[model samples]
Target: MKILIKNGMLVTAERTFAADIFVEDGKISRIENPGTLSVSAEKTIDATGLLIFPGGIDPHVHMHLPTPAGFSSDDFYSGSRAALAGGTTTLIDFVTPHRGEPLKEALEKRKAEAASCLTDYAFHMSPVEWRQHLPEEIKACITEEGIPSFKVYMAYKDSIGLEDDALQKVFYAVAEAGGMVTAHCELGDEIEQLRRDYVQNGQTTPEYHPLSRPAELEAGAVEKAIAMAARANCPFYIVHVSAAGSLEFIRQAQQRKQPVFAESCPHYLLLDDSRYKGSFEQTAPYVLSPPLRKKSDNRALWQALSDGTIQSMGTDHCPFMMEQKRNGLHDFRKIANGAGSVEHRLTLLYTYGVLQNKISLNRFVELISTRPAKIFGLYPQKGALLPGADADIVIWNPEKEKTISAQNHMMHCDTDIYEGFKTTGAPEYVLSSGHVVVENGTWKGKAEPGRFLRRKL
Candidate 1:
């Protein structure tokens, strides 16, 4: 298929200028100043009043994740489709192996599940435990599976978290394998004890969720993880940093020239812990791991993002039905620890981050697409708008406005954590690998399977 886009303001991590893009064989064939060249093709789009950018890339998400309540509502197909609708063309979800499961075996199963994705996808392998033979397995993941990044948790200790000793060992092994480690940092023991203490006094409402896992717990874990990664000399990427105190540690690490990278989410940036102040039905949806922080934390995170202390953003888009949240109605600990935002990352960021001048347009592109692609080994191919790059492009209308509502969302989940969050600017058209899958906020019904991106970092 061939397509040509003319008269659009081309925006990249570097600069923005009016240009014409030629696409052929699923890659950008040429880029030139507006009207410099002409090409006749299958499709020609007149982007006279639009902004053109590389499709958004969300580096963290959880599709079809399993928990005691059930699997996250959006599987790969639903989640990826929703992603495209929001101008995201690529996703890097997580692959978490059960206890005693070989990393390779879990990876294979995860790949099979992601085959249904509607947008290109990849994964961050999660190491739940440390074993003597795990170093060999980590190497195999890098060489054989083409997975060069691993996710380790400091929370969820009972099921998926790693102890400090185990986490350090895994960090060393991945560093040796030429891969980086992505960590979910929250003090597991402290949080566990706090939850117990909260429930013991009969305070089991959702409001207690944030109170149980305070900012100090998350910040303490960040300090410890940074130290551990520095000791092992491993490149570390922190996921879903949600606290002002946590940023102090990360900022210091960067000042000292440590190889620590981080990503924050829209919930943390735009919303606050006050969401948990409502009734169970109102507050349960905001109950996620590393619960939301105060507005002061939100302001601090925006500063970090603007100044380069944070490198990227993600949704951690795990979601369950409202009924799934009822499991913890009596005991807040039983509530599933996630909410849906996969389909809103780009819009929310553009609206608040760019339009508000918190970050420049170039920085926005870097945070959402370029930096993630570079860190995860999908750059030039997935995040760039240069000639020879894959044709995952977003034609954005700066004047478009949207009012988010769960009743109108595309994600399969019942609760929209970003419900009623009005957003400005939206994708007018989205092309995934040169295929126009979305036009004017409607799916074009292109069912072509998304290729699993094999990455090596």
Candidate 2:
């Protein structure tokens, strides 16, 4: 099918201009000035007043994640629908294996689980345990599965976290295989001890969640992980970097020209640890790993985003219902560690980052889309609006305004962290692989099942 989008303000990571985009068979075939193409198309969209951009790409999210409390409320179908509604056409979720499970098996299971997704998706293989055959498995993931990114957790010591030795070994293997590793940086041992102390002092509450996993711990873990990755000659990506101190490590590494990238989420940049002081019902929803930081940290993160210290913005969109969050009422340690924001990430960033002048329009595109594609090996095909790129586009109505509310959200989750927050810009139309999935605030739901993206380094 052929589709033509005319008279839109074309915005990309590098430039902004007025042009008409021509898409053929799910890929952008041409870009030209208005009225340049005289041929008729199967469908023509008049984007006279819209800003056309490559669809947003969220590099971190957890859909249908299994937690001790229960599975996350949004599965692939619902989560992808919400993502499309928010102008994100692609997402990268982690494929986490159980402790001691084979990496290949975990990938297969995750693939089956994500089969219902409505937007293009890929996975980051998580190496939960180091084994003799792990290096071979990493190679297979890169060569066979076409997934070039691996992830390791520095927290969750009891289940999914990896110690320094194991992490270093995995980094070495990934480096040798020409792949990168994204680390969840947090000092698990120290945090465990701190949680025990807080409980012993009879000060257990949602507010204590951030107190236990402090900035210093996160910075320390980042420092150690960078050193390990450096020793292994691995390209390292620090995920959900929440502390100002951690940015120092990333900056120093970048100064040395090491292959290191940093990611920060909207929650860490917009919200603060103060939310933890609310009542149990209110505070429980914000209980995520590497919990929200101080206002000073939030300010530093904004500066980092501007200065290129943080390269990408991801949602880490893992949500639990209010009822599920109540499981930890008596003990904050038992709370599910995530909040739902997959559908709000793009709008929030645009409203606060661009409208508030924290970042330029081009920079906003890079943070939410282009940079992630370049870092994760999905460039051109997923993040560019140039000729020959995938026809995943968002027609943004910058003048439109809306208030975020869980009651009206498309995500299956029952709570919205940004509920009642007002935003200026929104997606007027979203096309995934040349298929119109969302148009004028309505979901078309006519696109075929999303394809599994086989990415390369």
Candidate 3:
């Protein structure tokens, strides 16, 4: 299909200017100054007042993730639907293999599970445990599978976290395999001890969730992970960095010209620890990992984002139903450690980050799309507005206004932590691989499986 989008203000990570984009065969064929291209298409969209951007790319999300509380509410189909409605055309989820399973086997199973996705997707293969043969498996994942990133955990020691020794070994394995390591940083032992103490004292409510996993512990883990990555000479990405001290460490690493990237989520930037003070019904939705920090931490993160200490942002969007959360009403540890926000990532960032003058419009594009694309090796094809790039685009109406309510969201989950939050911008139209999947926050096309992208660094 050929589509002509004319008279739109094209925005990217570096430049913002008026241009026309001509998409053909699911790729951008031309980007010319307005009225300069003599192209004819089956469809001509007059985007006179819209801001055209590369479709958003969410690098950290869990669709159909299995947990003690059951699978996260949004499977790939539902989660990708939400992602499309919010202007995201690509998603990078994770493949967490079991303790003894071969990495390729788990990756295949994960690929089958994500066959229902509505947007192009990729994965960060996780090495939950390190075995001698694991190095070969990691090499095969990079050379044969074409996935060059790995996800590691520093918390959840009982399940996925690797001990320091094993963690270092895996880093070396991934480094040898020429893959990057994206980590969930939190000091597992300290957090486990804290949780036990909190539960033993009868403080088994959602309020204790953040108390158990404090910012210091997250920063401590970040420090350790940075050192390990440096030791292994591996490129590292710290996911959902929610602590101010963690930013300091990341900033220092970047200053040393290390291949260390940092990502922060919207909840950590917009919400605070005060959210945990509410009733369980209200607070349970906020019970995510590396829980929301203090307002001071939020400010520090904003500053870090503005100063280039943080390179990207993701939602960490894994959510469950309220009933799922209720399983942890008496035991905070059991609550599914995620919340739904894939559908709100773009609007929230535009309203709060850009409109509030905390970041430039170009910076917003970088945080939401370009930087992540570059980080996960999907750059020009997924996040750039260049010729030969994928025709995944978003026409944004910056003046569009809406109130974020669970009653009107696209995520399969029932709860919304940002409920009632006012948003100032919206995606007027979203195109995935040259197909219009969403228009005016409504789905416009039939459900189709998104292609599995083999990514590289």
Candidate 4:
């Protein structure tokens, strides 16, 4: 199929231009003036006042991801439904193994479950408890499965956090394989100690969650992880960076020209530790690691975003219902630690952050789209709106104003963290692979149209 999008403002991380886009068989065929077109198209859209951008590529989310709490909050169908509504076209989520399980088998099962999603997706293999045989598995993931990124946690006791020795071994192996290592930086031992003391002292509440995982702990882990990577001569990526102290650590590493990249989430930028208001709405609903920091940290996060210190922004869209969150109420340790922000990622960044003058529109595009693709090796095929690139594009109406609510959300989950948050920009038409999936603010696609993307090395 062929489509022509005429007279639109074309936006990218690098530049903006007034041009007409011609797509053929889902790849961009030409980007030129409208009158320069020579071939006829099956469809032509008049985008006089709209901004045409490459569809968002959110690199961190947890759909169909397994958890000890039983299962992930949302499945592929529901999660992708929400992703489309929010203008994201691709998501790269974690695919880690269960205790004593082979990494390959776990990835295969997770892939089977998400095979019918409604958008393009990819996976990052998380190495939990590293075994001697795991290096061979990491090589296989890169050479065979098309998954090249490896993740390790520095927190989450008994869940997936890797010990320092295990982390070094994995880094050495993945770096040798020409892949990037992404680390979840937080001090597990200190956090565990804090949790023990908090429980023993009867300090179990939503507000106490952040207090338990202090900023110093996160900063200490950041320093340690970076030093480990530096010593191993390996490049690494920091996941969900929250503290100002950690940012400084990353900055120093980068100044020395160490191959390090930092990422932050919208939750850290938009919400604060105050979200833990001693209520269910405040506590369990926002129980992610590196718990949201104070309002002062929020300003530093925005500064990091504006200055290119943070390479990419991802939505860690892990969700659990109110009832599910209740399981962790009496024991704050058991609370399902995640939040729902997949569907609100793009609009919130635009409306509240970029449009509000915290960052430029081009910078916002980089954070949500281009930079992720470059870092993850998707590049021209996934991130840019240019000739010969895939036609994963979003036509946005910048003047549309609406408040978010669970009543209107597409996710199957029962709550929305961004509920009642108003935004001015929205997607009006979305096309993935040259197929119109959403038009005129309504869905026009099926649930299983999405295909899995292999990691590019």
Estimated TM-score for each candidate: 0.99, 0.99, 0.99, 0.97
lDDT agreement with native, every candidate: 0.92, 0.93, 0.93, 0.86
lDDT of 4 by residue, 1-118 (tens): 8998998899999888888989998789999975677779889888889998899998898897656575767888889878987889888988878878988899888888888778
Runs in model 1 deviating more than 4 A are none
The TM-score of predicted model 4 comes to 0.97
**Where's the lowest-lDDT run of ten residues in candidate 4?**
64-73
Clashing pairs in 2: none
lDDT string for model 1 (53-102, tens) is 99999999999999999998899999998999998999999889999899
Query: What is the C-alpha lDDT profile of model 3 across 137-235, one tens digit per residue?
Result: 999999899899999999988999899999999899899889999899999999999999999999999999999999999999999999999999999
Cα TM-score of candidate 1:
0.99
- Considering only N, C-alpha and C atoms within 3 Å, which residue pairs clash in candidate 3? none
lDDT by residue for model 2 over 280-324, one digit each (tens)? 988998999889999999999999999999999999999989999
Could you tell me how far off, in angstroms, the CA of residue 434 lies in candidate 1 after the best superposition? 0.6
Residue 374 in model 1: lDDT: 92
